[model samples]
Structures are given as C-alpha cells and as structure tokens.
Target: MTEPVRLTDIAELAKVSEATVSRVVNGKAGVAAATRQAVLAAMDQLGYDRPARSRQRNAGLIGLIIPELNNPIFPAFAQVIDRTLTLRGFTSVLCTQSPGAATEDELIEALTERGVDGIVFVSGLHADQTASRDRYTRLITRGLPVVFVNGYAPDVKAPFFSDDDAAAVQLAIAHLRELGHERIGLAVGPSRFVPSRRKAEEFRRLMAPVAGEAEVERLLVNSLYSVEGGHSAASFLLDEGCTAMVCGSDLMALGAIRGARKRGLSVPRDFSVIGYDDSPLIAFTDPPLTTIQQQVSSIAAAAVRALLDEIAGLPVPSTEYLFQPELIVRGSTAACPSS
Candidate 1:
C-alpha cells in the first residue's frame, strides 16, 4: 500500500478535528459511529487507502442504469437506491446515458462482463412501447437478477416498480377542477413511453366529462420531458387558451412557469401549473410548484428487496408493483381566475 495519507488532509476534508481523524485512523474506541463513518468517507474522498481494519468486504456489485442525470428526479432515485444498497452491504455502479453517451445495451454488456450480481433499470427502454423487448428476454434467459423502475414490459420476466402515472394525472386534474379551472391542458413526454401514454389516456378520460373527447386532444401536448420541452408545450397550450396546465415532470413545470412569465402571465393568478415528481428544491421555486409526489424511497426499497430475493435464489414473481402518488399543494395553484 502507498504511504498513509496525511491526517491533517483527512481531518480538513471531513471537517473533523485532527484528533478525531487520528483516532479513526488508528481504530481507537470512543469515537461516535457517525464520526468514524465521516472520517472514513473523508479518507476515501481524499484518495487515502483505508487502514486494513477499516476496510469492508463488498457484498457484491449491482448495476444501476438510468436515462440521464439532467433531471433532479433521476438523481433523487439514485441517491436513495445507492444508500439503501450500501446499507444492505452491496455496492452499486451507476450508469447514466444521454444522447451520445454509452447506450443501455453497452452498459448492460459491460456490467454483465463485470459479473454484476443484479441490475436495476430506471425509465429505461423497457418503458418505451416501440422499443424491442428481446434485450430483456435475453437477460432473463441468462438467469440474471433484474428489477425495473418506472416502466413495465409484459414480455420481460422481471419485477417492475412504478409510480401510478394514471392516478397522478387524476389527482392533478381533480385539483385543477376543484379550483374551478375547466381549460386545463396536459404537457407530457412522447406517447412512446408507457408513463406518458398512461397520463395522456387518463387525462383524456377525465376531461371528457368536462369537454368532448375531440377537445381533449386539443388540450394534450406530447413533447420531450425537459424544461425546453415543457416551455414549448406550455406555449401551445397557452395558444389554446388553457387557464391551467399539468406537466409530466418538475422540470417541465418550471419551463411552463418560464413560458407564462414570458407572456407577462403570473403563476396561480393568471395561470396555474401542476407538475409530477416533487423533486428536490421544487418547493423553493418561484411560486413553489404544486406537484404529484412519487413514493421514491418506498419504490426504491421495494425494487432492491425484490432484486435481492432473486439474487438469493428465492422465487420472486415477475409483476408490476404500483405505488400511489400524492398531490402536494403549494403556491403554484389557486382558484381559477374569473373572466
């Protein structure tokens, strides 16, 4: 092993006293568990080799594949999953993909080669109706333990965990309607994704009682699940004279707010906006967003538990587990404005 890193460096990095760092390094008693953990984390962060006594044998490697980290919700899920997995004695290797980065297939192949004990997929290709299901089938054939989040593939034999997309839309619609808003529009991602399709279908069904089915389509806008996408969709909804809007993600809701402000409209006054996934810091946004809160921790824990069961050679039936979402009222929604 290389020369031991300086105690002062570890102490400064961990924000602990030098004596505390020395005690942790020397494996001395009397240190709080949390403090020891903090010192060790600091050592790891500082590129220091842990003393033999402080080293832990990893339970196993698990792969966590996600679409992208640009959105806060993905990171939120990652944090919870990572912490839970670590607490369970497993180490997680997170792989994130974007337009041109490593694709899901590439990451899967790499993880498989590395002999990962299990894999977790969040909002992956399994959620896209148009994507081929053969990839997941091959994994099942190889007897690899896998868990899917936020998407479902009937043909893929794996445990699936998802937030109730339909219920979320219903809640958003009901909240807006209770506020006396009739012309509420839905802004969501493309219909190719299962969650987006569910939201769109439910939105149409719920609004049919208010406006005819034909007008429902007019109020629905399918676009990317990004801020720019939300902004563009909100612009179109505004053109349709929508007084309230529901978005698929918090990023989109912020984008809608931006689009409204661009037109000199104030939120919850001239227009009301509701978003899905009450991501971190969303409550601190201007006119704090009213949104649907996904049970992220619960879903993550269930996904980990299901995967662990499969890894232990226990029979885990492949099925969809839906967690209910709740509507959190904030400054972004209010009674509909009177003409």
Candidate 2:
C-alpha cells in the first residue's frame, strides 16, 4: 500500500504553498508545467505516490552513449543530459563504453532494437579519426535522429556540439607565457582523437614563434588521458627542460603533479601546470588545479534541443557547434621559478 501524502511536507520541499500542492495533486489545470514538475518531484522525494492522473507519460526514449564514468567529466555530462531529458518527458537510456565492455556499435544495435526515438553520442567513435563514418551514415539514412557531442565527422549528417579545443589550448599557453615561462610542454592524449589533434595543432602553431617548428614538435607529448599517462609525459617533458606544462585533462594534471613530487619538486614553486576540464572537486586538490572549463550544461542542453528538433522533423543544420571554454586559475600555476 502507498503512504498517505503529507501536504505540509510536500509544499515545504517544493517551496510552494499547501494550496499549490493540493492543486497539483488533484491534477488541477492552472499550475504551470514547471511548478507541477516541482511538486511531483517533491512528492517522489518524500516517498508519497503521485496521483495516477498527475503521473507523467514519457514522451519517448533517448539513447545516450558516452565513455566510461571513471573520468569525472563524462558523469557530469551524463547527469545534465539525464535531468534535461526527464524534464522534457523523455526517458534516457545511458550506455557506457570501457575495456571488455560492449562496443559502440553493439550499444547502438541494442538501443535501436529497443525502439529508442533518437540517440546522443558523447566522445564516441565519431570522435576518432580512424573510425569509419559508415555506421553514422547508415543511421542517418534510416531516418533516425542523432546528435554528437565533443566530436565532428563532416561526412555524417548530424548536429555536432563541442568545446573549442584550439581556444582552450591558446588560453592555457597565453596564461603560462604571461607567467614568464619560456619553455612550456604540452601533455595530451592520442592524436587520433579530434580534440587532441586540435590542441596539438594549435600548440605547435603558437609555440612555433618561440621554439621553432622542429623544436615545438618535441615539446608536444602524446599519452593516455589518465594520471599515469600524465606522469610519464611529465617525466619526459621535465627531461626536455620544460619549466611549465599544459595538460589535456584534470586527471593528467594530477599525475603531472605526482611526477614532479617524485622528483622532489614542488608544484608552482618548481614547475607550473595547467589542466583541461575544470571538473567537480578539482579546486579542492592538494594544490588546486588551474584548468580550462567546458560549458557542460550549455552543450548538453543544446544537444538535447537539437535531437528533439530532429525527432520532430524540424530542420537542424548538419554542422558542428563549438562552445567556448573558460580558463579557471587556481594554485597549480605560478610564475616560472627561474624567471
């Protein structure tokens, strides 16, 4: 049996009056949609069953495919997307990829078999330069609505949303340069990924004026997007006499800090480091990380809107949408020790 609804508890939780709660509970017509949702959410939270008439009917199922949650940024994206879908009356099916797990193709097949209305891809195979575009083409040809985040495949006819990788690299380089660092190293992920390629290209272009083309190439280190990868890259860059470093992710930045410490060096005192993706709780690290922040909420909302438009048979431009990233300064970076 369901518990009795408590008007005071629900109203307080939803931040509305008892009358509003009563109206929502009774399925009254005057309450705004947002207000109704708030009331319903509050009721759900308080362990009260919503009146059958007030229950929401799901609009459709949206397939959300992303990388493993070990990376904090991926979860942040997933959470925003999931909440937005729920608010829009859509059910979201989250699919994650990892080693020994289902591949992207397999996940798509499963979601399609289950009759999802559309799909959202976050840093999936669409982002890999080496991956075939045929998979995406086939989906579009079948009249299925799809949207991509953080990756672009021009051959694939769909809306793409991403953070400006080149701009992020430029901002980090400029900040480090202002701190009087002459020899700065870049630690990024594999070149096959679109983001990594963009950052590397920009790093080479910007550093060319300072280090020259050939020497700038040596300053760029390709590694995994993990702490261990950052550590290994840091060791090599340190050997190259780099006084400051720009990392591809917060995880890598942490690894670089660890690497510096292992060599008996203090962060920002001996070496300055900048990271990408100002992910949650990063500001609370040993020496807070200075990073480029991706606009996750804006990107997620835009991608969801584009997918819904495509589902509604509305025209959406088949081009990439780039969102600007902000540079967040913290304790991880400082003036060059030698300067």
* Number of the predicted model whose lDDT against the real structure is largest: 2
Q: Name the weakest run of 10 consecutive residues (lDDT summed) in model 2.
A: 49-58
Best by TM-score: 2
lDDT against the true structure, each candidate: 0.92, 0.94
Give per-model CA RMSD.
4.4, 2.2
Candidate 2: misplaced stretches above 4 Å?
1-5, 27-30, 44-52
lDDT of 1 by residue, 1-339 (tens): 667679998999889999998887776777775677778888989889888766445899999999889899999999989877875668999999788999889999999999999999999999999999988899989999999999889888889999999999999999998999999999999999999999999999999889899998999999989999999999999999999999999999999999999999999899999999999999999999999999999999999999999999999988999999999999999999974
**Model 2 C-alpha lDDT per residue in residues 87-177, reported as the tens digit of each score:** 7889999999998999999999999999999999999999999999998999999999999999888889899999999999999999999
Each candidate structure's TM-score, on Cα atoms with residue i matched to residue i, is 0.87, 0.95
Model 2 local distance difference test score: 0.94
Cα lDDT for residue 200, candidate 1: 91
